[model samples]
Every structure is written in C-alpha cells, then in structure tokens.
Target: MNTPFPAIASSSEVRLPTGHHWLYGDLVLPESFSGLVLFAHGSGSGRHSARNRQVAQRLQQRGIATLLFDLLTVEEEHVDLQTREHRFDIPLLTRRMQDATLWAQSQPQLQHARIGYFGASTGSAAALIAAARLGSRISAVVSRGGRPDLAGPVALAAVTAPTLLIVGGADDVVLDLNEQALRVMQCEKELAVVPGATHLFEEPGTLEQVSALAGDWFAAHLSMEHAA
Candidate 1:
C-alpha cells in the first residue's frame, strides 16, 4: 500500500550493495520539501511497525519524507532473532545507515535535499554513528527512547548535527543513559522526557508526545532548500 499523503508521490523497495535491502521511501514534491528522514527501528521491530509508521506519517504531513527499512536481510533477521548474533552489531547497522544515506543522496527524487536520522532503541546508536560518519551531510537527528549510550564516546562526540533525545519518564534506565550521553555530545542538543510514558510508550497519548517532539525537532533543523 502507498502512503496516504499527497506529498509522497511514490514508494518502493531498494536493494543495496548485494546483501542489504531497504524500503526506499519517496514523498511527492510539495512545491518544495524541507528534507528526508531515515528511520532506524529498535530491536524486535521492522520498517512496517505500526509505531514507526505513525511517526513517519506525521513527518510526511509536515513536508518531510522518510525511509523506513529493515536493517537486517531476511536471512539475517532469522538468524539474529534465533541466535541473536549480529542484530546488536552497532557498527554493522551504522554502516548500513551510511549506505542508505549515500543511496538517498544519489537519488534524483532526493538529490538536493538535506537528510536527517530518526532512530529508536538500539537503532539510535546506529543513527548516531551514521550521523557522525556523514558529518555535515546530516542536517538533524532525533532519538525516541533511544540507547544513545551504546554509540560510545567517539560516535557521540563526533556528531555535529543538532540532536534531540526523547525519553519516557517511566523509562528510568534509558532516561539516565540519555542524560549521560548528552554530557558527551559536543553539538547542539536537547533532552526531553515525556511524563508518564514507558519504554515502549504503550500508554495512551505517550506516542503522540514522542511524535510531536520528533516532528518539531526535524522541522526546525531541516532546511527547505536542497542546496542549503
């Protein structure tokens, strides 16, 4: 099925470098667009997850495009879930994110636009690592209930893009981790904790808060002009 927003003209699956496969999301031009957002899901979720889908939908409404892809190949997902070997391989996931960023950079549909990363859970670490590697190419970043600490000091310190870290008040451990990571970030950053929300934000109205915070962060930082 296609995205409901008019701005998203079309969407499709893209194969990357033989082993990697991605859902190459495309949004229709709205006379102009702010930029593209690449989504990185947490453990035990995929591109089609309802939670991430909601966030992506909200971003589309605000003139931001999104790419939500499976970080693992079909076989890899099976092995990772079964044996739990490579899913937590932060470096590997970061590399995949970088490849996707490069792929988006080359596409005519997104060529001139800036790029942002929206990461959740373990994917947050991957996103941070990728943002660090991409440097000035990534315009902004947002983490929802993220494990930013997993990215390690080098990746966190290297990220130059403006970053927003959102955590649920009920998620005490993660909240603390985000706080610790924040101290290490050298770039512009903010930490917002949603009251009454849990780790997965399964409570009513909790996910909405995350969506709102993420939307605002990306909107403020993503440039309308691709060349900007």
Candidate 2:
C-alpha cells in the first residue's frame, strides 16, 4: 500500500503554545500534502520516537503531513517521570491535543488542510476525547497499541471521525481492551490485529504494517479531492 511520491517539501522543528507552556514538535510536510496528522505519543515518549517517525515517513510518501509533538513540558515530563502522574492525566492530555489541532489550523500552510490524529498508548484516549469534542474538525484517527477505553463511554460514543484501532495480536490484554472500546464506539471504526506483534509492535515488519494501514486510513478520510 505504500507507494512512491514526490519528496517531502519540509521538515521543521516547531514550538506550539498551549496554555502557559510551549510544546516542541517535529513537523513534516510533503509536496502538495493532502492532509495533516498530529501524533500523540504514549506515556514517556516524545517527538523522537523512532516508531512514530517511521509511520510519519510512510504517510509522507502518500502525500500527507505529520506533526509529532511532546504532550508535556520539560518540567512536567520530569515530574511525571518521577511520579508517573501526568501521563495518565487524560484531561490534561486532551487539552494539549486540542490546542495542537487549533494551532495547526491557524497556520498559513495548514489552515485549509484536513486534519487527523495518530495516537499511541495512553495518548489514544486523549486523541479520542479531543476528536469527540472537536467533531468533524478531526477527519480521521489511528491508534497503535493504545488505550482507547480510557476515553470513557461518552467520548467514545461522540467521536465523529472514522477511527482505526491497531493492536498487536499477541498482546492479549490490550486486544481485549480494544474490543471493548470498539463495542461502545458508534462511528465508523475497526480493530486491526497484527499477528505475532506485542504491545510495542516491535516484531519484524509489524511496524511497517501499521504504517501502511494508517497511511491508507488517512488517505481515504483526508482526501484532497474535496474541501474539508
């Protein structure tokens, strides 16, 4: 499903202001990108996640843009590293996601682009909550080894964007959780289990599959053929 396209046009380090703090991120824009996907990494991860960067690169080849950002400030991340508190604070994470989306929408190059979210781990819950609140502003969502159940019943029921939940088949507990979340979600959605993969999807070719699936989902939902 990964096809060749023109080279990426830009890759930049960006700082997004949310509340009183600034979050840093890496933004990649392909030539004539069709959509923009904002990434919300799982707990303790940031823009430097190699797995996320791999997925983002695949999307770029499909003419989609990507933003991989830190959900917490340096000070907050430091404290959370010790207390393990902020990573599980879903409300705070959701606010950051929303703020990032708004910030993207205000940008000159991305203002008219369709938007999506690529979330991992606990960040998936934040992405869902933000999508539920933002409604059609979020055109699609993809979760890789995530905790969507943490979004709660109300938020799951309210999500309007089409969602794809990718879980490792070998991760029994998380697969069960994804199934539970799928049952409560009323929108267009699916659960894709990657065989032989664990929670981190570190198995051979597994992450590549995640990239292909996510790229296809975003391409379908965030088409450049129509106005967003």
Candidate 3:
C-alpha cells in the first residue's frame, strides 16, 4: 500500500473502561493509516516506554496507527513495585488488553480498521490470549522478546491470527520459551531472532531492528484483503 508518510498526526489520550480500573492510553493515528495496533507493554513498563514508543513510531511510518497504554494504573504500579504482584499477572493483563481492544474498536476512526497487537515481555502472553479469544477481529500479532510461554498451552493453540515472535538470540532462556510456545501455536507464525540482543534489546541498533521487523509484520497482515 503506497502512502504519503507523515511522522505523526494529531493523537488523543483516552481513558479506557475496565472492570477493575480505568486504563490510560495514547492513541495515535496518521492522517491515512491502514490499520490500528494496540500495544501491550512489558512488565514494569507503561505507555511511556521508550522502546515501545519507538516501535509505535516505526509502525506509524508504515501507515499503521497505534494505541500505547498503561496496562496498570499508577496506584497499582506502585503497589506492584512493593509486592511484585501485578506485573506478572497474565490474567489481569489479558482482561485489560481486551478492554482496550474493545474500546479501540468502538472508536469512530478505528471501527473499520484492521487491528493488530504489538507486545513485549510478559505483555506478549496477554496479547496472545486476547487475540485467541477475539479470533478474527484481531488481524495480526507481533511479540518482541516476549514470554508467550506465560500465556500457557490452551491460549497458544487457540490463536488463529498470524503471529510473529521476535526474540533475542543471546537471551537463551527467553529464546527457549518462545520456541516452546511457537511449537504449540497452530496459527500461521514465524520466530525471528535478533542476534546480539539481550532481553531488553538495549544494544545500539538492536531495538531499531526489532521495530523494523514489527513494522513489516503489521504492514503485511493489517490489511482488509488479508482475511482474518
């Protein structure tokens, strides 16, 4: 899809309704975006994550819109820091993600747009579970150094969207876990390993590679003609 590239257009900050709490989201849409991707930030990260924001920007360059939000509220995040409780809570994260997705779909601008997910770290598990439960509504999923294994076997097998799991080759344990999840997934999927990266992809240019890989994946799948 050829597009007139705009670094960014106007975006809005939305308060999404969740059963437990209201989640904050930053929704950015280019003037002529083809799709919308709701981002699920990793454990201990929020809408302000530099890594996710970078990737979201890259997606924007590819003509895709993005919703980067806080999975946990400020109070909950503070509590988690003391208790180490919420960050790894897959079910909690999954439910919040679904709420965010439904909210995006309800938006006038995004209603007709194809939707995808960009998840990192433990957020990947939540993304997978939500995508599985949503079935065809979700068009694609991209996991960056994610823990899809945390989503468990049932969710992995139930997912039908095209999935791409990008892992850091040097992050052996996580790489192994992603591989295991890959084996269980029945969906059209691919595993991309970024050499010389750690779990955080903190190495210079490593994150750029991740953003590029994700941009391509979302661009390829988030299209009206790409059937769910």
* lDDT for each candidate structure: 0.85, 0.95, 0.92
- Worst-scoring 10-residue span by lDDT in model 3: 1-10
* Segments in model 3 whose C-alpha atoms lie over 4 Å from true places: 1-4
Preferred candidate (TM-score higher): 2 or 3:
2
Point to the candidate with the largest lDDT: 2
Better of 1 and 3 by lDDT: 3
Q: Where does candidate 1 stray beyond 4 Å?
A: 1-6, 18-31, 225-228
**1-228 per-residue lDDT for model 1 (tens digits):** 965444555556666542434433333344356788988889877888799989888887777778888877777788988888876888878888888888878888788788999999999999999999889999999999999999999889999999999999999999999999999999999999999999999999999899989988888888564234
Itemize residue pairs with steric clashes in candidate 3: none
| Candidate 3: tens digits of C-alpha lDDT, residues 74-193 | 899999989979999999999999999999899888899999999999999999999999999899999999999999999999999999999998999999999999999999999999
Clash numbers, per candidate: 5, 0, 0
For each candidate in turn, the TM-score is: 0.91, 0.97, 0.96
How far off is residue 99 in model 1, in Å? 0.6
Which pairs of residues have clashing backbones in candidate 1?
A: 7-28, 8-27, 8-28, 9-28, 112-226
Tens-place lDDT digits, model 2, residues 97-193: 9999999999999999999999999999999999999998999999999999999999999999999999999999999999999999999999999
